[model samples]
Target chain A: MNRQELVNLIREKQSYLCVGLDTDIHKIPKHLLSHPDPIFAFNKAIIDATRDLCVAYKINTAFYECMGIRGWESLQRTVDYIPSGIFTIADAKRGDIGNTATQYAKTFFETYRFDAVTVAPYMGKDSVEPFLAFSEKWAIVLGLTSNEGSKDFQMQRVGEGYLYEKVLKTTMEWGTPDNLMFVIGATQTAQLGEIRKLVPHHFFLVPGVGAQGGSLKDISAVAMNADCGLLVNASRAVIYAGNGEDFAQDARRAAQEYQQEMAAYLAEKLAVKQ
Target chain B: MNRQELVNLIREKQSYLCVGLDTDIHKIPKHLLSHPDPIFAFNKAIIDATRDLCVAYKINTAFYECMGIRGWESLQRTVDYIPSGIFTIADAKRGDIGNTATQYAKTFFETYRFDAVTVAPYMGKDSVEPFLAFSEKWAIVLGLTSNEGSKDFQMQRVGEGYLYEKVLKTTMEWGTPDNLMFVIGATQTAQLGEIRKLVPHHFFLVPGVGAQGGSLKDISAVAMNADCGLLVNASRAVIYAGNGEDFAQDARRAAQEYQQEMAAYLAEKLAVKQ
Candidate 1:
């Protein structure tokens, strides 16, 4: 999806929510285990239940990858099942040399048809530039991640600012806001405002909400731009809300609540811009 | 494989050569395309021909993933087909949060049973620790990459040293040389001696030999240690050496040349240590 199209979807849905499909086979409802493809079955229900409540679906590739070939089959089916116009993200965290990265771009963007794939910037510009080369497709580079490990190297002092700051600044020169976004953890709400100032036009995919204890209100308050340039992702807290037969219904309820909260945030932010 | 086992294999083979199975469908001989599983067929031939010439086989997962479910099947079969005691590497530059990284570790180590997997360190310690948690398995974290883009952030000044230097220093604290290694490109031969000083005990997986213009002689000169702490990888230059019926033979010939060159280096390094 392009920048304008994603912004329009945020406005149309009144929510910048990106539902993360970090669907683990072990965590899914036991009743579905008998099914041929349990992970896909579980994902089909979740997509059907909450497709309208969010603007995007971020599939964490690790969950599917753990299952091997069958997992990849489920991943292909899940991507095919999601309706178009809603942005899709392959949360693969993939990056390599230029040529190898091009193969990765083809894997996610061409084969799986995701709107964007999250990329690690440790290998630098060439590893990331391949994904951005695809038109309308996006490469969400890791910035200030929500995990405790983020302090290891990302927050290290680099020259006048943090390493992530250099990442955000130097990477922006490689691609425009149209084809690039940053994965800014919602847990880092304190730095959201400052991050916004650095790359005001680019979108931020915030993934630390809900189960990770990131506040939607705090993140949206400081991070949202005129176009509502934020994709607040909630994975476990929404999808695993229930373990019974009515799990999909429970997921819907959780998603609706987040959408409602996000709607209000959108209203306040949009009103301020006007 | 453990450090002792790997060191023993290096000595037994007298070559620290890692043959990269970056098997691409289009790149393989046309005759193999008619086979039910061309990729697996191609990989099996290459493995059978060069298995003795190299101590390790690094499967670049992107090529397999590009073909989707069938690609994954090929990957599973290829890994299963390799002879025992030869080290295996899943060159999948994957990393995420703690829980997610656990899934990745399981995917490569438990599900596929790879000896080691390459991981991107952008997310830091928690992202990388899960891979190290596996017994006898390895986490080859990206240090100084060979690509042109490595100059972007890796070489950037961070505190007293480069960002890659801090990565090498901090990441060493997470795991011992037994379970941890770093991906230091052969193109960065100038920094090999310095990097060896920082993490002398840990092994280094060096790529960018042939097809990428990295000299095997230059890399081994300064990088080899007491245990021959280096696994220099050559992908396209060896695997794609011939395009006809003699492709496997050609690949074997190419690998033999690298093995021969590496044998001399191993002898000199071992002699100096003795």
Candidate 2:
């Protein structure tokens, strides 16, 4: 999953949206809740419905983990459901000691077959380097998060620049933009320019746009690089749009709207490139 | 599970040791590898041998995750095998958006019944606070990691302190020391004095002391507070001590050595207090 290939996928699909599979059995439609495997059933329909509208699928492992064994099965099934061409993310937030991280890379890359796994760079290089060692795999390190706590550490003034800026500058040495990306919160629209200055070429997996009150237009305008360099993820705003039997269809409709918006953003980007 | 209770337990056991159950089925003894569930069998023996010696068990999720369903089952069984008095940690370094973080909290605290879980604080407060919200449960945020990469971001100069110092100072307000702990790499013995200044009251779960070449004596001297405020974790150096059939006994011996060293550290702390 190189930068050029990701950009090409977005251009080919005319969409930069990444639908998040944060599916919970209890949160799905009541009619399907009685199904033997509600989480997988919901994920299957969601993927089927929105597969054409998006370029990627982000699976948050926490929702599936709550159901224990059943949740894990749902995760494996959902990963299998997603098309190979589309980027698949295991939003596992994994980072550990070097050897431990090597094992984690093997689990997400070999055992589960995810294209990328979200990594926390707080542990520095050893925790993140193992993930980058794998071919075609990415280490999406957290930059400025959209949460209220973003002010706690990421935005705190560290030396001359913000802590996140320092992280971006230092971690750049670990891997190239091709094998590394940054998770810049969509809500931190004001910081995008500063973030871009730190890592101008790297892809930013921008979350907090839909349900978390971040504007897509603001994010796209401020963050996009020469490449259509953003995978704006909308989880609850898409998947849980309607908790009734039409949940999947509603999800598709929400995804289509995001895709349509992304198409315009990328089109403007291409127009600039031309 | 509360603060004082945990402190008392650490005192009564005369051990601040937390044996990390980073059990890889492939790394287990050949005799156990032939069992119906190798990881579980190995873990069960380890638990049986060391339950009385250690006050806590830290289950690093990656080892279990690699085994898939059977690994998860082993994790659950391992959690069950530990006696009620000991603390349990799902060393699953999880952090995400608010809603998703709530699910992670539910999974580890509610589903798996873990007393604590490691979290990467890079995503800011929202990613970590949800984990901290649970009563008696902990969010062990990564402070100074024991890896080559620690030189990258964590140790980077930020203001008058390091970036990790900022993380410790800022995030400390989000949760009380009772429910908040920091993962200070045992290898960073020299910086423990400064780290102690930043997070004096909170418990520190220090790793990298054994196979990673960190000094236990140095860590205890600089990091310990009034509460014997440290849980020194040794994974490979303890769990994988021997690959032969006597692996569990070897593990016990290694753990006993750590316990004895920790007892010496505690005695020093008591002397300092007196």
* Local distance difference test scores for all models: 0.93, 0.86
Off by over 4 Å in 1: A272-274, B272-274
Q: Kindly report the interface RMSD of candidate 1, rounded to 1 decimal.
A: 0.8
Off by over 4 Å in 2: A1-4, A272-274, B271-274
| Top candidate when judged by lDDT against the true structure | 1
Model 2 chain B — which ten-residue stretch has the worst lDDT? B25-34
lDDT by residue (tens digit), candidate 1, B156-193: 99888998998999999989999999999888889988
Model 2: per-residue lDDT, tens digit, A1-274?
Answer: 6667888898889888999888877677888877788888888899999999998999999888888888898899889888888999888888886778888898888888998998887778788889999899988888788888777777777778788888888788889988999888888888987788778889899888788899999989888888877899999899999887788889989999999888888888888665
What's each prediction's TM-score? 0.98, 0.95
Query: Of the candidates shown, which would achieve the greatest DockQ relative to the real structure?
Result: 1
Per-candidate DockQ versus the true complex? 0.88, 0.72
Best candidate (score: TM-score): 1
As for candidate 2, its clashing pairs are A125-B149, A159-B159
